[model samples]
Target: MISTRIWNALPGPALVRLLILLIVVAAVVLVLFEYVFPWISEYLALQETTVEET
Candidate 1:
């Protein structure tokens, strides 16, 4: 049974290109979130806080 009509409307080559583009974009986002982004945030937070004086 067919569920979607839009896939049938698209040419087969276009569908494959769309899937590949989605995968590459998802990978780029994950790399930034896991490695580069957290370090920048931590450095900024540390700069904002004040040390206690004895």
Candidate 2:
């Protein structure tokens, strides 16, 4: 697949490549949690409703 080809094209030893991949994955996760999650939460927030009786 394209990803496998790209992975094979990366430079350095297997360990170095693995470390780089891990760092990239971590960065993506951190960005999503820190930025994307909060932005999505703002739009998805639940509102409380009040009912009145006469």
Candidate 3:
């Protein structure tokens, strides 16, 4: 059964569908790497610890 009618609105062949899905995944990953990760890192600062000099 079709869970939602909105999804069916994107009519396309199998290859086209696969390409669109790939593009969407790539876009999300790009956003994470380019903006989201860097912004989050500023707050986390997961490397704050430092060794003392003798």
Candidate 4:
């Protein structure tokens, strides 16, 4: 329902649609890098496992 509503609301032009899609993708990537990645790094133990044995 929400997706359909969004689809229906979008402009009916190929170029405009592409622009909107690109803007949305850019915003999502920005949010992920700025907020989500930093928040997730605090919980992951990725630094605890390494190949160094000295």
Candidate 5:
């Protein structure tokens, strides 16, 4: 029953290509949020703040 059903299912190469694309996109997004964006934000905030008499 299972083998017959799989014979009628979608192709394997398409599924593999889709999974690889998803993995690459996820890795790039994670690196952007985890390392690049936070460092940029911290640098900008430090530049904005000043020691003033109040």
Candidate 6:
């Protein structure tokens, strides 16, 4: 696949390539949790309501 090809093209030895891949994955996860999650939470936030006694 394209990703495999891209991965093969990366510089450095196997261990270094693995480290770079891990770092990239970690960065993506961090970005999603820190920025994307908060942005999504704003739109999906739950609404609070009070019940009136009759």
Best by lDDT: 6
Error of 1 at 47 (Å): 9.3
Give a tens-digit lDDT track for model 6, residues 1-54: 998996898789999989998999999999999999889878874555567999
Candidate 3: tens digits of C-alpha lDDT, residues 1-54: 472453465569767866776787899999999999999999996879888999
Candidate 5 lDDT, 5-52, residue by residue in tens? 644463467677567667778999999999999889976766576789
RMSD of each: 8.2, 4.7, 4.4, 3.1, 10.5, 4.3
Question: What is the TM-score (0 to 1) of candidate 5?
Answer: 0.56
lDDT of 4 by residue, 1-54 (tens): 996776667897867877887899899999999999989989998778878778
* Candidate achieving the largest TM-score: 6
Ranking by lDDT: 6, 2, 4, 3, 5, 1
- Tell me how far candidate 3 lies from the true structure as C-alpha RMSD in angstroms: 4.4
lDDT of 1 by residue, 16-54 (tens): 857866777899999899988987888677657788999
Error of 4 at 44 (Å): 0.6
User: Could you estimate the TM-score for every candidate?
Assistant: 0.53, 0.73, 0.69, 0.71, 0.56, 0.74
Per-residue lDDT, model 5, residue 29, is 100
Candidate 3 residue 35 C-alpha distance from true site, Å: 0.3
Error of 6 at 9 (Å): 2.7
lDDT of each: 0.73, 0.86, 0.79, 0.85, 0.75, 0.88
| C-alpha lDDT (0 to 100) for residue 4 of candidate 1 | 51
Q: Scored by Cα lDDT, where does model 6 land?
A: 0.88
Model 4: which residue pairs collide? none
lDDT for model 3, on a 0 to 1 scale?
0.79
